[model samples]
Target chain A: MLKRYLLSPGPTPVPEKVLLDMAMPMIHHRTSEFSNIFKEVREGLKPIFGTRQDVLILAGSGTAAMEAAVVNTLNEGDKVLVVNAGKFGKRWVEIATTYGLDVITIDIEWGRSVKPDQVESKLIAHPEIKAVLVQASETSTTAYHPIEEIGKIVSLRDETLLIVDGITSVGVYETKMDEWGIDILITGSQKAFMLPPGLALIALSEKAWKFTEKSRIPKFYLNLKKERKSQLENTTSWTPAVSLIIGLKSVLEIMNKEGLPNVYKRHALCAEATRKGLMAMGFELLAKDIPSNSATGIVLPEGFDGGKFVKLMREKAGLTFAGGQDHLKGKILRVSHLGYHDFFDTIIALSSLEIGFSQFGLKVELGAGVKVAEEIFKNHLGV
Target chain B: MLKRYLLSPGPTPVPEKVLLDMAMPMIHHRTSEFSNIFKEVREGLKPIFGTRQDVLILAGSGTAAMEAAVVNTLNEGDKVLVVNAGKFGKRWVEIATTYGLDVITIDIEWGRSVKPDQVESKLIAHPEIKAVLVQASETSTTAYHPIEEIGKIVSLRDETLLIVDGITSVGVYETKMDEWGIDILITGSQKAFMLPPGLALIALSEKAWKFTEKSRIPKFYLNLKKERKSQLENTTSWTPAVSLIIGLKSVLEIMNKEGLPNVYKRHALCAEATRKGLMAMGFELLAKDIPSNSATGIVLPEGFDGGKFVKLMREKAGLTFAGGQDHLKGKILRVSHLGYHDFFDTIIALSSLEIGFSQFGLKVELGAGVKVAEEIFKNHLGV
Candidate 1:
């Protein structure tokens, strides 16, 4: 009998506890009971965001918060620097361009980490740059850019703000928001937060709030300035995703019990094992430099059809992993080790990969990959 | 011991079955399973919206879809007629103004509906007006506007689109999107859909879609044209509220079983009973001209203390109803008879209202309201 496993970077498996917490009868969002819960959620999120600033919880996907970050921080025709390394980085360029911003895009290679020196050069070239938009860990490519270095560069510029897409990064790694001087950071519920994907969590620095006050973009639902005002009163500006927020409270409590550092270490161990295991299976690692602990991308071997392989995994073993996007489609696979996952899941994924290879007539290493993973797990400090 | 009941106008109680559907094991949104369900939801919403056009589901509160309707169908500096009747109507003005629309507002009384003649006169004076925004039922005042008549007027103008906020109206009343020539219509999950408040359902006519193409508003997340393109491929432009969408599938099935006509009749019967019941207890209704079937707004008697009465209901009887907003605060109370509610619920609400009245040191006729509601239920098609 085969067991079903969810390994998608997005919509990661939610803890059953969080699911049950959300499943309980929903209370009115306008009530004091919910307000207290929301207030707690707001405060709870600050530690994870590594900020003392108020974090805004929105009733939409992560893209909604990303859009909120863009439209609420820059005015029309404002210039910005966007690092386009992967899918989400491209999204930053897209959103900025869509909002009539003059974007100076630094097009880095896919699956490659962006150099902060490149941003420094571009910012130097564009004196009017209002913001630097990038992802902490690009989910599509599993590449972690040096956001700390980028934050250092942006912090030196009085006119420029740093906005990080922490969708798959926050709980998976130590995203030192306040420490690194990140002006705006965004995350989603379904990632390392271990909840459903409806709620978008956003945190802004005091500088970002100032930019929000000056931003002239037309917004009603995603107006963070207004949201900030209502949040100060222990309520949301609009009706939030009540069930998801309740789930967030419970999930945050779980993370608190596990502790943020331990959560990061757990995800790191799982991701490292997965990456090492894939390499042992004769698969090429997608991100050669600074691979993310959030998810691991693998380049399929020559003559091994990726689309057919993924379809086979799902049909044969009930295993679902994300396939490549854009130009890399049918050439790579991504296994998510983020959120509510551990070494056991990594072993299962490796076993599933081996089964997929043998079924496709590719050379089978048997448990060679799992053995590599086992060695790493046994030797890992925390484990 | 008192049983808890949810009677808020927006976040009406979710059916236990629907909640269970949401609580079931979460599924990947990118898979065929979720796509099939989304397709079903798309088709199911068309009838309730009274249109053949595909309704786009957004992962946000109804206000997000309202902003989408405004931003996706109009350009900057476009003249529009806003019917400022109540809170929701005022929202139309706020969104339009936020997007830099040249708004010609028809300011009506808080509890009143817009007169089409006034709109017609305004349209005649302002020939450049591109759209007219109004609500089917204003939740705050519990008043139903003359959307049918307004639709007739807007339909005559080829340059102007009719946008209706059906958040509290769609399943509660006959919106008639196609029959009445509504160019845009929107609804929320927590209202007539009998689900949590995360999914916003929006539909656009061919004309509205055309407007969407030409709309010059700076938008990224609320872009409907992008959403429509992706929806054609059986997916959303972004990750949606998957659990709520799953719950939506079940709730829509329940709604289909009840039938739109029967649902409307049920809401009508309940609202009529509630209004009559309140009046029987010597309390006057706030909505004098056109009371809505979705909810009932009652005017507190002089020196009766509406706030104290609502608080008493919650404390002593475990009942929750909506207090007034803005100018109506502490003057009126709103009782919702929207989705997942029945005649028995109406009786319970009436009994709770009577209990609250007596507890607040106001003269009560004991079972006067419930008796009236019970009599109406007995005479209705089914008790």
Candidate 2:
């Protein structure tokens, strides 16, 4: 019997401790017992988001929270600037246009991050734009954008709000939402939170809260204003993802015991080792500049079938890695370093890649990649 | 240590087998393994919903599906008739009004079900009503509506649809959606599904599909048409609650093994035993006419302090029961037999209620309520 491992960008491996904690008998959410847990989990999320504002927990996927961010702060016909860098960036445009917002995009190549100057120039060109939408890390391309720099560019304009989708970045790296002038920040539970999907955490600045007063988007389930009132009282506006919230409390405790700084450092080491090991094996990365610490996208060698490779890895080796989407399909493979992953996981990924390349008729030295990864881990012993 | 028991209607206790199944390591959603499970779960939900139509699984609470039922079928400025019998029934009116629908509600008392004749007359008077929104079992008041009779009336008109919120009744009772001509049916995972409160299941009729083509409500997250296309291919449009869906598969298996009819009989037996036991103890039921088989609502004696009774049962005796909402607050108590429940659970509830009564300074004959419950159980041995 072959054991299975999940190495995808999202739906990463959940810790056994967290899983067993969630497996306990269900409790009523309205009771004071659950209220205490909710209060702690809500407070625990703020430091990771780097915010002082109340973080609203929603009972949907990351996309639902992304939709909430757009509908709750903007009205029909409101002009907005979207940074179209990858799949998730394009999502912001789709959500904005669906709500009747006139969108002006700062388009960039799929693997590269948008320049801060480009956003500033777009704001200058369209002063009527009411918001600048972007991503902290694009999961599709494995690229990390300069959110702090972009936050500065948008902060100069009082009328424009800065909205950042930090789904893959919040707990993986440092994202100071308040200090960086980010008006709104969002993340999902399946990413760095080391849990299953279904819950999304979002926070809004004082400035973003002011926009809701004048916004005219009609909503009920995703209404942030109503949710804030309930959340402040240690409850959710709707029936929350209760089991996930309980799992969240345990994960936060785990993260707290390890210290957030060390958590970020561990992710950094895993990502760096994977990237360095792949480079040593003569493979190129999709994200040439500013690679994200959450996941690493590798450019498959010529004549290699990525679809077949991923399928074989999953079915034969019982290892799950993500293949590319859209145009990058059959050309790239993405392996995640986010959420409950460590150095050994990185070593296993590199060793498998070495074997996969050999099976695909490519020349590869045995243990070449793993040796480099081992050296990196050995150098950073504490991490 | 006090062993806590959850007897609430919504967040009911999940079976240990289902909980353990969910505790297994997480898997990627974009794989054949997950797709196969999803396809099976979707197909499994059809027999329970009693519909041949494709049932869509959403990753939010019950209210999200209620909103989806509205935004997908009817457009802005549409008029709808809502049966406002209890708290959840009032929710339909609130959701419809939030999305610009002109709501005309047939207001009824808290514990009484809406009359089918009244609904027929309302539809006859207002032919412009796009839909008749209602609930199969009102959890707040423990009342069950006559959905089949109302469905027959609504089916006679091709222009109007009948939407039923079966959050507490679908698996607890036999709801033949296709036979009864229900256009849209909705339920949550936490209630009769014996899981947590993250996933909502919805199914739409062929006639309801036609309504979506002409509807013009702006939506993105709760877009049912987009979700239907993806769900047909054994996937979801957004990230689903993977763990809860896995738990649903196990619970459905348990139900299938017992047979759906037997499951319904179990719920009916538990509900009847609860009602009879409370009646034997001289407590009046809130639902005087047609009480739901999901839960039993009891009216406390004069100056009995229902809130204090419920609190003591929870804190002191480790038994959790729901207090009355709205006007019934501090005057009634609700105990559930919705999912993963049996006759013993009813006996425990009755025994505790008897103890709580005496502790709260009301004279209660010990073993009086439990004896009637035991007699009922003995009479229906196979169930």
Task: State each model's CA lDDT, in order.
Answer: 0.88, 0.93
The value of fnat for model 2 is: 0.92
Residue runs of model 1 more than 4 Å from their true location after superposition: A379-383, B381-383
Residue by residue across B1-383, what tens digits does model 1's lDDT show? 76789987978888888888888776788888789998998888888888888899999999999999998889888999888888888899999999888888988888887677998999899888899998989998998888998888889888999999999999999768998989999999998888888999899998898888788887888889999989877799899899999999999899889888989899999999999999999887888789999999988877767777667676666788989898888889899999998988899888888887787778999999988888888977452
Task: For candidate 1, give the lDDT.
Answer: 0.88
Q: Can you give the lDDT of residue B344 in candidate 2?
A: 89
Best by lDDT: 2
- In model 2 chain A, the worst 10-residue window by lDDT is A374-383
Each candidate's interface RMSD (Å, one decimal) is 1.0, 0.6
lDDT of 1 by residue, A48-139 (tens): 89999998889999999999999998987899988899989989988989989998888988899988889988988887899999999999
Model 2 Cα lDDT, one tens digit per residue, A1-383? 99987889999999999999999999999888899999999999999999999989999999999999998899999999999989999999999999999999998888898889999998988999899999999999999999999999898889999999999999999779999999999999999999999999999999999999988899999999999999999999889999999999999999999899999999999999999898888888999779999999989987789999999999999999999988889899999999999899999999988998798887888799899999889977765
Best by DockQ: 2
DockQ for all candidate structures vs. native: 0.78, 0.92
* Candidate 2 lDDT by residue in tens digits, B1-383: 99988898989999999999999999998888889999999999999999999999999999999999999999888999999999898899889988899999999999998889999999989999999999999999999999999999999999999999999989999989999999999999999899999999999999999999988898898999999999999998889899998998999999999899999999998998999999998888999879999999988887878887788788888999999988889999999998988888899999988887887777788788999999989977765
Please identify model 2 stretches exceeding 4 Å from their true place.
Answer: none
**Residue B257 error for model 1, in Å?**
2.0
